[model samples]
Target chain A: MERSIRSYSPKDTHKIGRRIGTKAQSGDVLLLVGDLGAGKTTLTQGILWGLGGTEYARSPTFVLVNEYPARLTLYHMDLYRLNSIEEIEDLGLDDYLYGNDLCVVEWADKAPGYFPVNHAVVQLEVIDDQTRRVTVSSETAHLDRLVMAIAGGADE
Target chain B: MSDQDIALAIDTSTRYAVVGVSRDGQSIAELSWRSDRNHSVELVPAIQRTLAQAHVSIEDITVIHIAIGPGAFSALRVGMSTAMAMATGRDIPIITIGTLEIEVHPYLDLGQDVTAIIGAGRTRLYIGTFKREDSLSNGHVYLEDRDKFLENLPVDSIFCGEAVAELRSELIGRLGPDYKIVSAPPPTRSASVMAEIGHAKLKSGDTTDLADIEPIYLRSSQVASAARRWPNTKTE
Candidate 1:
């Protein structure tokens, strides 16, 4: 299932992320695909907030991954610096992606084929300086409730 | 005792980077710590520290033993290459033991089939089935989905390893009271166990050829071949 919503401001985007995060389960993976400044980190911050994380979530670009404790542990990964599939593979991603945690990957399009089959892809497209279109899609029903939650929240 | 009596064991196959120094099958010193993903940076210094603590010079170490893995890809490489390089530099024999074998070693006395598991990310596991009589063999480790593996487990099968804690509820729920699950102590504390296994292999002449030994990465071919593409690239 898939859902798309338009965010007229960064705050709106964060709210959408929070909605998704609240419904996330352990072992859930959210792949964020967007250009620079497309609010990936902002959305992640909102997701972290939704998951009951108090510390601010930052871009783990140089560090590659940053772990935040929440209702379910959040493993936030940034692949902007990794240029190839091998670089991503060396991240030992299986543990986070497969373990009992919620993993959110930034720049996930860097290796489209590298992630597991069951994951939700969150794509963001900038419409203007302050507007963006966020699309969440997944083939498996693993993320159906999350998609529904986001869709339901967007209507409010 | 001759130089051949000192053994160094390295296992960076999981979150823990473990180093142990043993002399004549007895442990002299050992260190194990959660390394996150810093194995490449942490392993050499760990080796130095363990050797220093044991009062054994690196040059006096005659054998190197490594846990080749069905584990973290880069972590396993860090341990394997360090062991290989040290062995090559010293012109000593290097013995490679399967990580699962080391994991299953402490449970072989139960006289039951033991299934040792290492988490393979995403509710999948790298599992090794060891018949009590032939616990030393390395031919049985394979990857399987965790739920399926538990559902099909034989009655009275004993399970152990780092992944056991996470699977305890599931194992008990699915298999009911017919199965047994033994949680091993934290892996870092088991470096001495790895050293003992290495020592036994050393005494039995089960050393690996320096030129042919490679890390045992039991991933699917797609991921395996992709990893092979950048074999020379440093992970960190």
Candidate 2:
């Protein structure tokens, strides 16, 4: 249900991303939590790249959500500016999360109420400017193993 | 033209701005504000928030549909400018909606004839008629000058817009109950309505170039605001 990870640098963070990307599914919802510049965006880039061979998987904060049409459509969402829970429904967001696309949400904690129930929650805790601890939460056994593998493989 | 696109609707045409409305025709997701001209600050965040809220992102938004005018020059400029800018940068096709029509829609009736107008100046007006496009679909709007509008007025045209009440006596005395006046909501220029109209046009291969799709300024604006000209703002 819940697993944890640690990363020493950007490359270590990306290893966490690669495992998630390799294991992501069409209806999977990945909720990333971290403070400002905790390498959440860096992890996202790795996940998006691994999932769909995409080269661009930025924060998508100012631009809202960015979609890449590759092997599987990857939806990247940054919720740093969200106001109300209705803001989620207004944009028709769940359509993608429930559809045939992989969803990654940043600052998902800001809204607190809108995250789907079965989503994988990634919590990044900064130990120093260069070191970070990441935790994953999910119910599916497959994903639990994937998270374990990635967290174990990460040589932070 | 032969594709099902990710239709986008941005409505920053008022004090209350809408970054990107849903493909659905029901409730709208609006970016509300008071006195600040904060579209620059609110727009992208609103878009991102709305997109994340819906669980989709900008990439899911294939067709950039936006409101053009019948609103504040700045707010109106926001949706169009942002849409055009995105279309240009992303190489996506753009869909333009009539700002006045969206505003006047809540007041329109299929059973009764209707005339939609945003104010021009003096007695002259920026008038457009909503002739029945179909039984199920909303009517069409011919955004043009008053004389042309008056000439094409559908039988029993009920007038409602910014200055319709101002011309109420003249219009009523002239057209009677057949052409009455009504009030409309400010966020009326919905991307949903535009999607309906634009769909027909788009299906018939009637789309304009992304660069050519500009605002539909019903008339050369007077010193008054869109609320005065159209109902894109609150009623005075």
| lDDT of candidate 1 at residue A64, scale 0 to 100 | 97
Which runs in model 2 stand beyond 4 Å of their true positions?
A1-156, B1-4, B14-16, B24-36, B104-112, B119-126, B132-155, B161-180, B183-185, B217-236
lDDT of each: 0.82, 0.63
lDDT of 2 by residue, A90-123 (tens): 4646445545567889877655435444577888
Worst 10 residues of 2 chain B by lDDT: B227-236
Q: Per-candidate interface C-alpha RMSD?
A: 6.7, 18.8
Cα lDDT for residue B154, candidate 1:
52
Per-residue CA lDDT of candidate 1, range A1-156, in tens? 988898888898889889988999988999998888999999999899899888899999999999999999999999878877656766777767877789999877656556777889888899999999998999999788777757854536
Count of residue pairs whose backbone atoms collide, per candidate: 1, 14
Q: What is the C-alpha lDDT profile of model 2 across B1-236, one tens digit per residue? A: 43465556676655556554445332234343432357877787777776776666677666676777554445567667788888887787776666556655655555655566654322245555665443323545433445555555556666676556555666666666555566443333444565555555555665559758766543222212322332121111
Q: Candidate 2, A16: how far from true, in Å? A: 74
